[model samples]
Target: MPNEYPSLFSPAKIGNLTLPNTLAVAPMTRVTATQEGVPTETMRRYYERFSRGGFGLVITEGSFIDEKFSQTYAYQPGLANVEQATGWSPIVDAIHAYGARAVAQIQHAGALSQGNRYRDGTIAPSAVQPRGEQMNFYRGEGPYPTPRQMSDEEIIDVINSFGRAAALAIKNGGFDGVEIHGANGYLLDQFLTDYTNLRHDRWGGNVEGRLSVSVEVAKSVRCAVGEQTPVGIRISQGKVNDFMHRWSETEAGAELIFGTLAQAGVDYIHVTEFEAWKPAFGEEGHSLVSLARKYAPGVAIIANGNLHDPVRALEMLGDGADVIALGRGALSNPDWPHRVSGDMALSTFDRDLLAPIADIKAAEVV
Candidate 1:
């Protein structure tokens, strides 16, 4: 039989890097690293499984970018230092051995941090307390602490850290590309969110001002990785703490956000939503993936969120998504691409795979 999802198995390009297929593995936080932020052997096998299963691109979970004020959870892997970056070399090699490209998603926890080994407290755009309580899965209890506002010098440091980490991922870790974790209510997303960021300076206030840090980070990563390396930024309106949140500016907000990143020379924009096919703003609005394509026509778009279904996954291509990234779906069926293409039955995702703690389980490796 002809492939049911032809678009998903087609070749695609993100910057200079060419993927074997448009199917990608979405970044999912798996706090299974050593306490010192080194990637473990288990992590290597875990990532390699996806590539070995025929994924064209494998994006690792959000690795902490810096030693200070960046790590969000205990045992979370990092690209912050040489040792951590070096530790990832094997995993990258493993992915490459299976003909899949590896991309590191570097992030900063900011005010939403539940645990941090480098520092005692958290820092954010403003001194506001983040909404919602700590995630028990990541190992935290009670509500989130109010973070101190960062100074001008510190803001520059945060931007520089991203560049440094991207460089480490490329030079030390051998990653094909690096993704800036500006989404999911992290530090960059904190600045983008209005309530989370209440500053009058150039880093806050209006949409452009609020997104200034993201734009600069994208520029910094692009500069650090050079013109040839593929550099992308993940964008999402919702947060791990505030899932139902929406951009106040809606489509107009998307125009500025996506347009600015494209102008900053980002090769791709990864947009995620609870449901990939649903409208971004309201019943009549376009999906966030379509908006990203509309605003940043020059860059590739990776659409995440509930796109595991073959029908929905194929529909996303028409919606302007250059790639379909799977989270829970991949966890359930690492060989989803091969299965879909061969007309094989797909497996159902089990919450047990991530229950108790979100760490990588032994069963997942084999």
Candidate 2:
């Protein structure tokens, strides 16, 4: 049969790692891990099915980087400890058996953490109250708590944790690479966003100061993963906690941010928005992925958010995006790539199905 989406099925490379297709499963939170942040058989099977269904790359759900305060929810996986990294080996092996590359999304919760079990208080760039209430989807309730201001030393420690976690993920967990979670209003996002970061120190004064941590984290992770392994950084204007936020109001600002990451030596930049095709700033046609490519022509771009339709996905790829990452669309239809290729009907994703993530059976994956 003729392929419906040729761009999607075409091979794409991240550093030296070549993906079988441009379709990738975006990182999604499924709190089905062990209490100690270890990946379970269920988690392994969950990701394995995505690989079998034909995704070329499987970016695992955000795994907290450190035991100190990075954990955001109960049952969330971690890459900080040896045992936790070992837990991911079987899952990576399962994905690899189907010829898919697995990448760990390493993150820190910062102020949006509703389940920071390690430390009593949450940390942020500045002691500001987080936006929005805890999402009910992740067993979170009530208003977000105000975060504690991070000291310079603590900031350095967080940056180092990202490097250590990436090293552990590749060395012990068998992951192809690591994607630093610099988006979605997490610890890294907290620093990048102006409204949240009000500190006067080196880590929080201006745009460059705000972006310093994320760029440094990428550099550190790149060093940790070595030159062969791909190290990508995820960036977004809006965040999970603050959906209406925009990091840069202008295209020039966008260039500066993306250029910084490219200069930092990241193999790829994952640009995410509510809709990847929509214009990011001045007009309705210039999308975030377009701007990212304009700024970082040397880096691969993965476009995420509301790109479920084959035509739209194709358009993004036509616009210079190397990959299309599926989130909810991939969840409902694990065989999304297969369906798109064969031109089959796609199952509609229902948010209700994720209420109790553990109960998500394979039978429902179709």
Candidate 3:
């Protein structure tokens, strides 16, 4: 018999926020935003579906914070202005009304800004071209346009932008919290992986050096959001540029990212994997979540990726993750949490059609 979750429905307090349960919605880019980069009705409805279905929390798709250079993809949402926030306020309010906490994930595309029409150039840790093909989101090329090497000033600017974004997310946009997009080989992960960050400055060299900017961003965001708002960072061993990419050769490398971010006052850590249950580091005696709990001590950890059923979700909680984020599972089965709690059989989701439904705007077209 599968291990039961006596505490699955139990409330978990994250930072100052008390969630209804241990389940959370991972922040995944929906790739659909209003023309001026605001939260559209489509997005609100998309998220509300999950919230109404009993998701404990819903982390919105990535919203670009720095418009000058960080607006990486076309149609990507932005938090650089008040107008966008005005559009976003309702979405957050809607999520809260349904009893689910709302969090906005702020991201900068760095070199992955394929259709990045916001500026003449983008920034990356180093100038080495990404090794993977660009997604169809950018209709123009392979890999992506090479990004400009960020100057010291530009680097500091990017870090501060994230802090400011967090402020707007809470005060102006009505978000309950914020998550730093540190994974999937984006801006923060670029600094973590050696294949991308080939710099000789304060932001590069060993694990400590590479982790500086990400940790600094967390520290800054904490200060900006104050001690009350929950803040989390997403990290993954894989990369958008290189799917098979592994940032650290050992668990020590993973520890550097996890421990340092936790020390910086991050309220939660979202660790992602192609499959959440796999061994994050072989030498580490446990899975990624186990290692996170071991090193961070008390920080809440959210694990995401391919969690297919209630049995798997229950297993993840048993594995040491404080919360489990479902992507495909939640999209197809909107009533997943309720169904699991009520003893209803889980729905069978068609993997091939999930992306469109995941991208579907339930309230508005375009």
**C-alpha RMSD for every candidate:** 0.9, 1.5, 2.7
Model 3 scores a C-alpha lDDT of 0.80
lDDT of 3 by residue, 317-352 (tens): 888788888877876677678877777777776655
- Best prediction by TM-score: 1
- Candidate 2's C-alpha runs over 4 A off are 282-285, 356-366
Model 3 spans with C-alpha error above 4 angstroms: 1-4, 137-141, 282-285, 351-358, 361-366
Across 1-366, the per-residue lDDT of candidate 2 in tens digits comes to: 327677788899988889999999999988888889999988888888899989999999999999898999988999989999999999999999999999999999999898766878799999899988987777888999999999999998999999999999999999999999999999998999999999887887778889999998998898888999999999999988788676554777798899999999999999999988988874565898999999997999999989988899899998879989999999888889888788899999887777654334656433
C-alpha local distance difference test of each model: 0.94, 0.89, 0.80
Cα distance off (Å), candidate 2, residue 249: 3.9
Residue 125's C-alpha lDDT in candidate 3? 93
In model 2, residue pairs whose N, Cα or C atoms come closer than 3 Å (at least 3 residues apart or on different chains), thus clashing, are: none
Model 3: clashing residue pairs? Answer: none
What is the alpha-carbon lDDT for the whole of candidate 2?
Answer: 0.89
The alpha-carbon lDDT assigned to residue 278 of candidate 1 equals 93
